[model samples]
Target: MDLIDRYIYAVTRRLPTEQRSDIEKELRGLIEDMLAASADLATKSASGPASDQTNATIRVLKDLGHPALLAARYRGSSQHLIGPEIYFLYTMVMKIVLLATGGGLLIAMIVSLITGAGGNPFTIILETLGSLISGLAAAFGWVTLVFAAIERFSPEKIKLDRDDIFDPLDLPEIPAKKDRIHPSDPIASMIFMLIAMVVASFVPRFVGIFWLDDPASNFIPLFNSAVFMMYLPFILATMAITLTREIGKLVSGRWTLGLALLSLGVEIPSLILTIVMMSNKDLFNDAIFTQIFAWLHQSDPFYFDLPMKILVGRIVIGLGVFGFVVEAVKTFVFWIKRAD
Candidate 1:
């Protein structure tokens, strides 16, 4: 293939299939201009009507830059989508959307089945499957259209002005924010943990339900199951907190106090768990102390004895107190300065 055709193919192939033909046409037009320039140059030169097709093409291509570089220019010199990242993000977003929809639908169906709606088993299953498929197809169609439209409308074709010209545009850059959840985060997490602990501890004793005509017998999955189910709330809360922390740093800017408060909402469970852990020793085996005594006794199990655990715990608690005092003093000083 000719140099122009090869260059066009290399670049337009990187674009969406729908856009490739139109892009190829534009690229060919550009090549034609370059070829014309070279031909005119040859005619005007003092070499006496000399013309070499290979030399002329090489000269034209060389002036246009490397094939890849020339192709990249069409994606807008200032802002453009890289070949790989475009497809990757598209797929990633599509996956998240699909998962969200599918999960919601599945949860709903399962809950409905568990609640015992009067319906034929086979018919219900078939209906559910058909509905799911239909919903997924409809969602896929809309989602695919949205992605395709975004790809089509990408501002990759805007001609960039040469650096020699005066420019006035200035973009504001938002700094990445840190997500340091306030004390509130720990509170919510503690609450979730406690709820999980309580439900795990007591809820099973009260759970009695009949699945079939058989006597209502055998409640609570297992002790391990109870523990896991109880902790589900805390696990979910922690994940939410972590997500907010990351997202606060990203799309929303920084981890502001507002986000910290939101994290606290989740941390409530954690605080409750911590408190419960501190007050209750019977809940734990001999090896496991209530959360408080455990923290107080925390030491290298292999390296330290009870004495060292107490010693280290006391020192750590002292340090925590000292830190609080220092912060309080600093705040007082700031207030004094403001008053003066």
Candidate 2:
């Protein structure tokens, strides 16, 4: 291509379409005129008029950053996922997910060693791989889901907003709508969570009444049976919603009801077992909680030993707190979507 043409392209690349043709024409004319003027000015020299149009074009290109940088000037701020913002988010999330996956495997290895899960090294390695794969997949699944959702529903896609650079004459004032519509309002979520927290804080008391007198009622296997009674609210509250929402949202569109059913299904079975064991006096102390409690009773200043007696208050109040939290999240998400 000609020196003038190359110079024109380099300059025009940064300009928007509206001004590109005009700028290209102006640039082309300027380069040609400058070269012609230079030749006349250098009539006395062997260096030959600023070293020819090619040399002048090379000098001009060096002053400009690049075709991409030039294009960016007229384009203004961007909303692309591959841009700086996404890179930042991806870097952060990647760090977290990788840590989570590694931690899961590390925990699995430690537990496997303690439990003597398998007799052979091969089996242990196999178990470790299984645990690692599951953890990584879950981490990536949620991470992918996050980016996908953000891409689909980012606020920039909504055309109702006007650019900040506005002219009063171009924009007429329209009366605002009475309703303020937004996606996932945090205030509503906070209120709902607070209510759920209150509810979960109390449910165990009501539920624990069923377990009151049975001698076998307190022994819990993986966790303290009394923990089931006292903090059932907290455990069920967090787990039910977190598990259900994650699982339900993964499988279906209707998450609120699925989470509700999931909470009931998950929470009720254990509650039933607790009630049955409590009524039958089949409760056993959690070896860990028992040991810890024994140590605390012996070591601590509470001049009294905390009776390992099944706590009616703990069960009722702890679960009440948990249930209240999960329900609150569900209700908040449901209503916000409904409003939208």
Candidate 3:
């Protein structure tokens, strides 16, 4: 019964929400009928009904094949630019690119506002919007073009080769249920890293504050743009490594020592960069702070000078370090335990 329930869940989960209830009900009824028929046949032969029913259920599920394949069959074929073989990969790539582009543009816009790139807040916002739209369009077009080319010329490249791919005996052992990673975890991490990289590399200026009264001229940039740009290559390299590791996890569906090591590879460099950036005294725009304090001092004569900019930078850097260490240690421990 548990197996049957799990099978039903697996099949229906891939379906649209509106169709799931009906499909689940139908599957349950069909399975029950099959089991009943098998039970009756076994009873006629003086065999146990419960054992026969279990065997019948297993046979029925095996004949039905993978749940994903069954779900696809139920959905029926529809025209698509890419075939099912490569469709999931195509969508994943598109999602990453779009998110990165949008995130980069948003960061750029914020930086522009703080740096007064166009000398006016309105102009900065307009430029940011324009960049975001254009960047998304370009990314979409490029990804579609690449996938379309693959679909057109080399469809077989993405196909699972039955003849020469691997030895059946050498296939990976099935992971323990407890150790198996959920498919969504790596996907979410990939998206998050892509966005973070875009923000760090492309929009460092946006990490600032603005005075509501004079939005155009009273913006304060947190980090020194020139200094941050110097570390762009390292940031990008770390992002690339993280992306590759995440994609591997997506394909493999579990964590391993290799992945844990790669994760540390990403974290170490990132941690170093965070320390370097935070240590630079020039990283905080002191002029902006001075200007803000000067404006506020007029309204509140007793207003004391507070090093909010430095305090905020330290807090952010500290949090980043903490998160990176926790993840790295956790991954390393999991891998070690698995090895043991």
* Residue 133 lDDT in candidate 3: 78
Using lDDT as the measure, the top candidate is: 3
Best of the two (2, 3) by TM-score = 3
> Which residue segments of model 2 deviate by more than 4 Å?
1-45, 48-54, 74-79, 82-95, 114-145, 156-340
Worst 10 residues of 3 by lDDT: 155-164
lDDT of 1 by residue, 291-329 (tens): 234557854344445533344445555564565556456
For model 2 the local lDDT of residue 262 reads 58
**Candidate numbers, best TM-score first, in rank order:** 3, 2, 1
Candidate 3: residue pairs that collide: 110-206, 111-205, 111-206
Candidate 2: TM-score? Answer: 0.35
Shift in Å, residue 134, candidate 3:
8.7
Query: Number of the top candidate by TM-score?
Result: 3
Off by over 4 Å in 1: 16-18, 43-51, 77-257, 264-340
